[model samples]
Target chain A: MSPKVSQEHMEQRRAEILKAAEKVFIEYGYERATMKHIMDAANVSRGGLYQYFSNKEAMFETILEEGLSLELDETLEMLKENATSYWDMLMKTIFGEGGEPDDEMDPLAPAKLEFFIIGRNDEHRRAYGKTRYNNGLSIYAHIIEDGQRSGEFSKKFDHEIIARSIIAFIDGLAVEDAMLSREDLRIKEQSVLFVEYLKMALGISEHSTDGK
Target chain B: MSPKVSQEHMEQRRAEILKAAEKVFIEYGYERATMKHIMDAANVSRGGLYQYFSNKEAMFETILEEGLSLELDETLEMLKENATSYWDMLMKTIFGEGGEPDDEMDPLAPAKLEFFIIGRNDEHRRAYGKTRYNNGLSIYAHIIEDGQRSGEFSKKFDHEIIARSIIAFIDGLAVEDAMLSREDLRIKEQSVLFVEYLKMALGISEHSTDGK
Candidate 1:
């Protein structure tokens, strides 16, 4: 193969392996998952897996980075477009296209929780987690700040604190999802209530769609 | 010794062992902590530690139950007395005696997170977690319900959902605390913001002290 074609093929193979690794991590959780399992699932030889990733932690980190980076990019793009109202923008950022909560949760949530919680004491993992958290925080803070600046939201509360609370609520739900049954989580109800909170804190009426 | 005295001695020893186990769990975290560590910390014989609790899970459960039950009882007693306003009672229940957020966090918080996250799939542990969650939920819900009934809080939102959000915020902070430095967690700031949310959702003014 030409050098250019070879480069493209290598990238495709790496993506394929990551897809398979994600399934194994989700199924068995981070602590229990093994690279051998990823190799089998990806239909790659042991050497092939090792050539792409050194360890499970490296694989998991890459998966998390890719997913979060995609989300961050999408949110930044939405903000630049300014096609949606601030409230709707915030909702879409949190709950995806419909901007509503349902019974569904990220399937990889438990594995992600395990990865961070289990490795919390490790300096490298903790540093990475902090960076990921700040990145997530910035997305929400940007929405709130824009809303405040545009007179769409009140300046009654610190935009960053409000943003941080949003992260807390979502992270808290992830923790609850791990421990409780889906029915018991009341994810939809809590989310609806949280929206009410954001509206009240932002001093925006529920009916307001000024920027829509 | 008399039979009654012997029984008291046994109870005292059990409490001492739990105290030592709590220390061990806090120092090493749940996944790494062992019965042997507890025995060494408590300065007890293998048989002595085993006599009161069958395993590490049982000991940890007892520690959690004891702490929560005590908090629950205190909250219930405060409610019966009607010695404080609804807002103060709620704040006190969440933040303890001063009804304000501070830098301190429960020493056992990380260990508790580890226990539940690691054993999330275990039938027995999951059941215990659900029960514990409900118990914690009732405390906040009760405060909100009483406030609404007494005309101190707004009936605009369901008290149960408000209560659940409070738990989510607190649990989310705990998760953040594990992965980030204390400064990064911004525990006090996030907590103060949450209090603002509770105020808005309940429709109570910051100055209100109707029952105080």
Candidate 2:
């Protein structure tokens, strides 16, 4: 009889599979990737792959659902904890609030770009984007709504619309970071300037010192 | 004997095919669509379709390329002709410098939103996005570079970077408009608002007077 897998071992095994699956899926895309490809990438046999997950779709759902949700969740959490001013929070979240990675550049930029392509061309129903929006939009809309409620924001326009616009702006940047010519893409400072302008659009008062 | 089509008739036929292609593309996306689908949708026969274009890819390119160049040229013309301020130019160009379309509440929002997704999605290769963005980022970069050279704007940042950021903001709004709930999408007014923000971002002063 096979000994039961420990929880830690199970977690490691799952991560190993996900890492393997992500590369394969990204390289091959969803429809073209198969269990064999994933197994070969992971260096696991068919039985071992099935032991870890049910099938390709199941593997995909597991991969996508957790990866996307976690990336977004982490970003939102940073936004929540980093609120000295509105732009501070946005910059922190977007430019990586956790401090520089090993590369000292945005590691997420590549993945975020990948997400935009995947999000747009997934061939899935619109529900996927809608669902992610519902999770993120409500949180962000509430932030704007709360600011308005607290008299920190002007009532010049709809916060819901503002939140959606901001999200869209971020999405746009992510896609650009992925697809645009490296020479044509904005640097970190340029993106920060954009957030400054966005602060005005959302009717957020600029942080006193950042006006420079 | 077949009647010879006039110059105006040929132009009219091309426009009709593009319009039909746009509609079918919005419904069916590029991969699933065929030349036959566009030909049928345009109410033109096989020979008529072939006379106008080589293949579905060529037809798609014609529809997207010419449509955007026309839009960009028209926008630049309005910029050249419109009244005094940068803000007004942005508000007008982005929010219907064409002025409200006759016989419609508003269709440009959805129409543009559709085109933007098609432009930004990764499903299309770099070359296709390259041509589309030439009508977008390349044009905006030229304008910004001109603005900086003429002393109308600051040059503290890379003009191309800022231009792409501004485009990203607009593209973001378009992306959001396409992806969000209809009731929740950024409407024309919000789009106008973002364009206003864009003017400020580019160091253009706000318009004191309203367009409408």
Candidate 3:
């Protein structure tokens, strides 16, 4: 009984460390971010941090696993809830909260891109990256396939293709965000625009506010 | 004079070095690629190569400037030719030679992505990356604006937004290409499908071969 309680506490502590480490990685980027910075950000001693993660890479992999999979699970759950139209659900799954523009981009985007791009030359990292990317692609494709079955989306294009395009657009924006200043890229506006493009491709009626 | 002949020969030698360096970079990637690999690939002595480029980064920057901007300039010239429809011209500008599906992906994509993603933490690199990205965006936007003025494309959405979407989709594919194997992502097919999506968004007629 004591061991079980301690295990639960460790998991909670691990989550806290990941949360803080993500912020530090975002601010400083992956190459510049250090284990010391993570320890400082998490407000944990080196011993405490190392107890959960072996190194910065281990901490990053943990963060990515949690962040990427959690979002996928949440989006899938939203699809299952059936609270809105399929199109609305798709948009919500993508943009969150009625698909409105946000003031800032996802803070983790830079680190995420860094991980995958730098991982290209590494066999282990490349394999892991492929899994995460395919998982991401499947989530969006699954939503579109579901929408098609429900007659909410057009059958003009393959659902898989459209889903891939969505990934491409989102990934492209993240790439731009990594290299360019926020003002130069207009990430939010570009997202809304891509959503509009999705509507056209899916044969859905355009929203009045779209493209304005 | 012999000096004139020597200068022309030197220009030819520099071009040869860059071509070989590009091939080496493609195979090993930017981080893993060594100066020795370039020296071997180019068949130039270390002293001979150093005369042209001070370092690997310098070699890469020269390659990028020539490769990226030269393509941009060529596309812009194609747009000016007026021999093709605006949509066809735009497609050619993007995918080359009428947007046909090719057997292979862009060879330089991995290195280009590495340069920019790794640049996120470096001020000098980050600045150059932004300029290139924005320059790429504006080229697309300029073509779209021109098309709209000629009534070839409906001004349904802001041209700049569509332009950004184009960047996102292309960039996104590069990101996916960097991480996932070619078979899994189907980069060529995705590009073709995306062109179909752009057709719908732009209110153009669908081609029979589209979205296959």
Candidate 4:
């Protein structure tokens, strides 16, 4: 029989399971990673696993939320606390150049993409696109508008357009990282090089952020 | 009963079906736009549809090929047509934003993105990204390496990194266009805005290609 752990112990167990789950997902890709593997990795019984989470997706969702939340909080906090212009800190975050690297990614992205691509059928991709388009964009749009109103940025180009472009840029970066490519793109210098290109692209300097 | 038509007429009918398929995919989103819907819009028998294409995915692939082949061909042609600075025209062709407008876009982009994102999980997204990355970027990398050799752009940065970033930037633009709140983003002005931002990022003369 599975051990009858207390509630506190169960919560700790769930965290441990999720921690293992993240490693499996990263190594195997979401579709290929099996429940048996997760169970073995987590060192939990079948019934025990069910008690803590409903399914693989629920487990992933929790990990995704907690992981991305931590990463986003750290990235945004770095940007906000630095008191540098949005452009500089944004590029730095992308490069993982400065401050502590809180997991060099937003965890929800690959899973969100895999959901659109792998899960469901034809009816799903379109619906997912609509939702992805809506939810993925609004927060950034609000952020851009705030930057503009506060005079931290300019209103020369369409704020929505800039926001969407930046969203796409970040998305593309995540895709780069997700690839099982022949080239070793994960090294620190390579990553920083890419981020510097983005910095120049956004005109992130005190010289150019003057509404240039 | 199916109506008989000349070979030329049948070919024209096939073209019409693919065109309608594009609209159908975009209109209903990729997943929900069924073969039945596409048949109704394209005025093709289900048998005829199957004859031209095996499934919704096949039809989507054909539509993408029809739309984007010209742009890709043009990029390759421009690369070899002259001994001019390949990097300069490279920006113009992909991101610099000069093209004969069709419907509401530069024709190649909106549909390319639509089909790619629709097939984000299919062999198509992988194929599309691979073909574009391998062929287009392999060519651009050559030019950047040449520039590095000639000591124009910085030799301090990896030519491969810059080439990939530029490709990612262009891909990111297409993805942004593919997924955006329509109210916030206007398709007509997208190419122009993209070019402007690209020029700023690259720190090039505002009118480099104007006299050419």
Identify the candidate with maximal DockQ: 1
Taking the candidates in order, what DockQ does each have? Answer: 0.79, 0.36, 0.69, 0.20
Worst 10 residues of 3 chain A by lDDT: A203-212
Q: Residue B41 in candidate 1 has what lDDT?
A: 99
Compose the digit string of candidate 1's lDDT tens values, residues B1-212: 99999999999999999999999998888988999999999999999888899999999999999998887788677656754688888988888777888878888888898889778888999889999999889878988999999999999999999998988988888888888889777789888878878888899885685443
- Model 4 misses residue A39 by how many Å? 7.5
Docking class of predicted structure 1: medium
Q: State the lDDT of candidate 4 residue by residue for B1-212, as single tens digits.
A: 34655767878888888888878776665655699999999888899888888998778767656656866676667656643654465554554234322114233444444344434355646666556556666666777677667644446666676666656655555454444444444544544555564344344454554544
Candidate 4 residue B120 Cα shift, in angstroms, is: 7.9
* Candidate 1 chain A weakest ten by summed lDDT: A203-212
Residue-by-residue lDDT tens digits, candidate 3, B1-212: 69999999999999999999999989987877889999999999999989999999889999999998788677767667743677777788787765565536677887888888877778889888888877877878987898889887889888998888888887888888888877888777787777766776677776522432
Instruction: Compute the lDDT for candidate 2.
Output: 0.62
**Per-candidate iRMSD:** 1.0, 4.5, 1.5, 5.3
Given candidate 3, what's the lDDT at residue A27?
90
* lDDT of prediction 1: 0.87
What is candidate 2's CAPRI-style docking category based on DockQ? Answer: acceptable
lDDT of candidate 4 at residue B94, scale 0 to 100: 51
- Docking band of candidate 3: medium
Candidate 4 has which clashing residue pairs, if any? A122-B31
What is the TM-score ranking, best to worst? 1, 3, 2, 4
For each candidate, the alpha-carbon lDDT, in order, equals 0.87, 0.62, 0.80, 0.59
Question: What TM-score does model 4 achieve against the real structure?
Answer: 0.62
